[model samples]
Target: MTELPRDRVRELLDAVLDDEASDRDDMARRVYISPFHFSRQFRLGTYESPVALRRRVILERAAWRLRRGDSVTDVALSEGYESVEGFSRAFSRAFGFPPSAAERTSTHWLPAPNGIHFHPPTSLWVDSAEAPRSSMDPTTQMVHHDIDDTRYLLELAGKVAVRDYDRPLLPRHVVLGWDGPEESIAAVLEHLIWSKEVWLASIDGADVPARGGRDIGALAARHETAAPRFISAVQRIAAEDRWGDVLIDALCDPPESFVLGSVISHVLTFSAYRRQVVRQMLRNVGVEADQGDPIMWLRTRHQPSHER
Candidate 1:
């Protein structure tokens, strides 16, 4: 295995998790420096590309979760499998048996085709390599937006409406709707718009108000309104270097207005919850969002720039 310097290795690792290096072109662009130089250093240092490292990390985490007694199903999908069958096949190939074999032993290890073995009670095998970083890596800071490459998965809802075409307001997730504690994507967007104002209040002299839901034509409109608000706030914050601390504090500590979200864990961050809602909505309609690839949508105009 290549011995990677921690910082540089971390950069390569983040690139993989964010899927910035999916294709040869993207991988070349992300590895940066000279292609030959990076390739050699990558092998010498991390012993893997951004991609292999990422897979190793995911599998390691999954193994840890299994040892913690998390259900195999939970571990599978969390690692990004689309279906139980798919996950089971892959798991069997990796572990020599399906995840079911895991339940039999507390700290059993099953060898994987990926070169990494599935060692349960992975905490004991815990390499610092397996720990999740505190703040998202730079590449992952804006992950929520890039992860959903396709804009407005509203087609499924449109189809549903077209089939019957009689629901004045589109039902949230068709299956879940907005009946439970879980808000719809529309609600999540509205909350995201308000979250900016809330964040600003914690920094600038603004006052955080109840989340604005004055009834827009669509959730996109509300999210759009916040773009200008976030732009203005970030611009003003940039003017004063100390304000970076303020934004961080705001990010870390939700204002009183956000207490409801914090309590539910569902309404937390604007980008986070909204991103999750989009993925769920897509799943409900059978769309596989590019959750693994955060840079896929960075080319779009929806960026939240950290003005310097």
Candidate 2:
């Protein structure tokens, strides 16, 4: 697949936004390509049709102007809409609200697949960060909570009597079929840390990680090592927009493949369940285990200790 060079892509984009370029035919002429080829190239480069991108960028600009207290009629006429009624319809469809309400919106940017958005003062802002900008994004929030809660459980497990830590109190508690039963605090905690180690190994293309020590100190050590690496791997995947990329695991008897996104989801799902299991196991041993609810975790995490 021949991809457009960045310079050429910029040139074509510039031509599309040229003030005198009235339509697709005019845009193609400015770029010295036939209308058909220009459309094809533009779509291939930006994953959007030229006309559609133009309209979106225009609406984005209108949104920016409106949020800054520009009159709807003024913005509508400046963006080439024939009337305020037509502009209102387009704005409502693109932004899910009338232009009159733009001042109340938190952001002016809409969902865009290509990451190309309108820059202030007549330019394009190409966002290279494909992932959510905040650490509090849902996936990252869950990952942080999982890591924190797991470590807290390990600390609680360390205080349990050695016999209770190893006792099989929860009967027939199985999460994944292949990992077998997790009926003891030791078993559940080990699985919780070990699963992340295994997945990180697979992601790094290293040989399968050797099963580590199952004691509290050992489990804590293993988790401390793997937790940051796991978070780094997920961040890299998101930054590169590689969630759909596949990993072929030769460690499987017959090689198996997994999508990167699904792999993260699998780890988070099972880890969440195992965290609760460990909490219950702690309670069974007459230890105080926090509720382990993310809602509570987030609330307590952000609020002042005095308020909590």
Candidate 3:
């Protein structure tokens, strides 16, 4: 595994998080790289595009300040938003609530594909477990994207009515034969969580876990519980270089065997399919969801501006 040079990554991160650095071109200039290569290298190292990381961490700071009773206008202006209304809209979109509601949420940190976030007073917090210790592996990137995207979809689904949630969006659609039809948003989301639960159980040699409820909230809770375990399990497997290792699953009738590598691959393959299905279902039901593309999901393209 090739790791990015820490010094270069640190320098790039410093440029990105600098209060004076607001544009990708400026960040590129600071790092003495062209904007295109800078963005690419930053994503390669940080698992997030520079602009998206800056924007999200800034909003995270704004959320923290708002929670501490900072005026929305003050925080908004300090965070570079031109107006309080603009700030509120962005805040609401990112946090799922207005600035005024910031005090109600426990943590200001939003869901980041990379674990980079605002950490108190004036610093960034990177979760060592979530952020790759080595170079960003393609497998790790996809796994992180899949989990984060599923969580994002669940958040969007939580706002829809139960009737619409259960409405069939695809006729006769089924990914795994035994999992049954995944034609509705609820069913797709259910299998998304279940796939993790069942696989993890088999991996751990534990009994098959009970299926979670179909409610978006319940599914969200189950995901919160299952996602980290799934990530940790994958991380452990990778750290031990156990991808090619085989496992005997007593959970399967008369027992079955699987290579760790293929197990995760299978889950990721179908989870990707189900995620897009849910996204389309959300759009059809009058809720907006992203394109669910890994390219788009992992990075954002910012307009060029050489403000430095």
Candidate 4:
């Protein structure tokens, strides 16, 4: 079978995520592909049929809602199941537990075959396991790899020429999908640091330090202080295996709740994307920034010079 383009698959997956009520036919129509071809391509690319993927995603959403205290009947109806019994049967098959049991125990559900996972009410992303593990066990060392690269990127950003530090390399609307008062390189770096603090505050319920202004030095220093806190938090979470604890985020107007593991995944995803943005911006301004590829970082950090 011919391999489908990854970008096209991502588009289709995003469409499915946007509307779980949409059937495979609707999805094919939206993407302007025939249902037969779309189904074949989707299955080949994602290791699951389009319909199966959508159902699994919807069921995962249902599990998250159930954990967040939503009634099983309401979640069932919202997810398009006609009755509680039907929803319960499907939920049990997908997650190995009924909706009520999931709500009571509040355990972590397995990720989708495609590696796309959700954190409830909001937040979804394709898992990119590009970073190398510091140890054989992923659960223990993934966060350390993230922390190391985060600090490295911040140090590289600090070396950008002073005049170009605050220059607008990419518009805020393009980078963040919305307009903001500040759209400079420095603003992106500050936002990167500030985002971690936000997640840290949500995880620990402690007062975080104020965001460093446009000064890259100050931002680096603030990040140096904040990065360890996040490392500690992740270590603690990993040690206790509390990846499924529900966290109520006070930052949202209605207050959003997400599984703790999802929040950590969100942090890793956000950091990876923004760090590359900063690296590219630095390169644009004539700084000889490393490519900032996580794998390359790992190779340089681990293997000796004469290994090859």
All models: lDDT? 0.43, 0.81, 0.81, 0.66
Write the residue-wise lDDT of candidate 3 on 84-136 in tens digits.
89998989967878999998889998766556789999988987755654455
Candidate 3 steric clashes: 0
- TM-scores of the candidates are 0.33, 0.56, 0.58, 0.51
Show where candidate 1 strays beyond 4 Å. Answer: 1-180, 210-218, 243-270, 286-288, 299-308
Mind giving the per-residue lDDT tens digits that candidate 2 earns over 14-96? 88888789999999999788886676466545545577778878999999999999999999998999999999998996787
Q: lDDT score, residue 183, model 1? A: 40
**What is the RMSD, in Å, between candidate 1 and the native fold over all Cα?**
22.4
lDDT of 2 at 229: 63
Candidate 4, 130: how far from true, in Å? 24
The digit string of per-residue lDDT tens for model 1 on 18-133 reads 53355434655675655544443443233233344445556656656776678988888867878878877766654556676666655444222112333343222323322222
TM-score preference between candidates 1 and 4, better one: 4
Query: Best candidate, TM-score-wise?
Result: 3
Candidate achieving higher lDDT, 1 or 2: 2
For candidate 1, the per-residue lDDT at 81 reads 76
| Model 1, CA-based lDDT | 0.43
- The lowest-lDDT stretch of 10 consecutive residues in candidate 1 is 299-308
| Model 3 weakest 10-residue run by lDDT | 299-308
